[model samples]
Target: MALVEQLNRDMKQAMKNKEKDRLAVIRMVKASMQNESIKLGNKNLSEDEELTVLSKELKQRKDSLQEFKEAGRDDLVDKLETEIDIIESYMPRQLTDEELEQVVKATIREVNASSKQDMGKVMSTIMPKVKGKADGARINKLVQKHLS
Candidate 1:
């Protein structure tokens, strides 16, 4: 099933199970997806666009969790963690460290990137291949490691 379709079904199940936190996260995801669609002139979002939205949502929650932790707000941190978990459930499985390194090395070779100066060339070539499967920060680190 498509992600949106699965989200709709999960929303209904959340309501049925009286899962307030889970329901709230699902509603937030649906709203974000809708907003993205509207931004694209009311067209349905492509899978890539949908994955981008999901990743953005997850990133926001992670950032919030850090802030909440620093402020000593365990309640909010817990909620944010839960939301992160829910959002991540919809994302593609992330690459392992070794797998990411292998990909970065392959991309560098493919782009003929030999030094740190070629970082941009390597990143541009690799990002599309790993989109929705690897974190941009992690990819950047791997690229830098291989280039330097």
Candidate 2:
């Protein structure tokens, strides 16, 4: 089934089970996905597009977790972690570090990125390959390390 259809079914199940937190997170994801469809001026989003939405949601929660920790708000940090868990449930399994390294190396070669100045070239080529599986910032760091 398509992601939207799966999400619709899950939402109904959540409502039936009275899973408040899970239902709220799923509803937020649905809203985000709808907003993206509106922006794209399209009636349907591909699986890749849906993954992008889930990835963005997970990233936001991670950032919030960091900020909450920095502020010493353990309660908020825990909440953000829970949110991250819920959001990540919709994403594909993440790439292992070794797998990510291999992908970055292959991308560097494909792009013919030979110098640090070619970082941008390498990143743009690698991102889509790693999207939803690896964090963008981690990809950038790995690219920089390899290129340097």
Candidate 3:
């Protein structure tokens, strides 16, 4: 089933099961996906597009968790972390550090990049492969380490 359809089915199941937290996260995902679909002037979103939406939502949760932690608001941080886990359930398995390192090395070699000056080229080439599987900040760090 499509992401939206899957979300709809899950929403009904959550309601029946009285799963408050799961329902909330699923509702948020539905709203975000609908908003993106409308923004793009389309009625349906491809699986890849849905993944992009989920990725953005997960990133927002991560940012919120970081800010909450920095401000010493453990309560909110705890809630955001829960939501992050819920959101990530719909995403593909994340790449391991070793796997990410391998890709970065191969990408750098493909782009013939030996310095920071070629960072953009290497990143642009590799991001599509890594987008939903790994965090961009991690990728940047690995790229820098390999380049220098």
Best by lDDT: 3
lDDT of 3: 0.92
> Order of all candidates by TM-score, from best down to worst?
3, 1, 2
Q: What is the TM-score of each candidate against the true structure?
A: 0.95, 0.94, 0.96
lDDT of 2 by residue, 24-116 (tens): 999999999999999999978888999988888888888888888999999988777877888887888899999999999998899898999
State the lDDT at 43 in candidate 3: 88
Please write out the lDDT profile of model 1 over residues 1-148, one tens digit for every residue. 2999999999999999999999999999999999999989866888989998998998888888989999999998888888898999999999999999999988988989999999999989998888889999999988888777
Weakest lDDT window of 10 consecutive positions for candidate 1 = 39-48
> Which pairs clash inside model 3?
none
Runs with alpha carbons beyond 4 Å of true place in candidate 3: none
lDDT of 3 by residue, 87-120 (tens): 9988889999999999999999999999999999
lDDT of each: 0.91, 0.88, 0.92
Task: In candidate 1, list every pair of residues with a backbone clash.
Answer: none
What's the TM for model 1?
A: 0.95
Error of 3 at 117 (Å): 0.6
Error of model 3, residue 131, in angstroms: 1.9
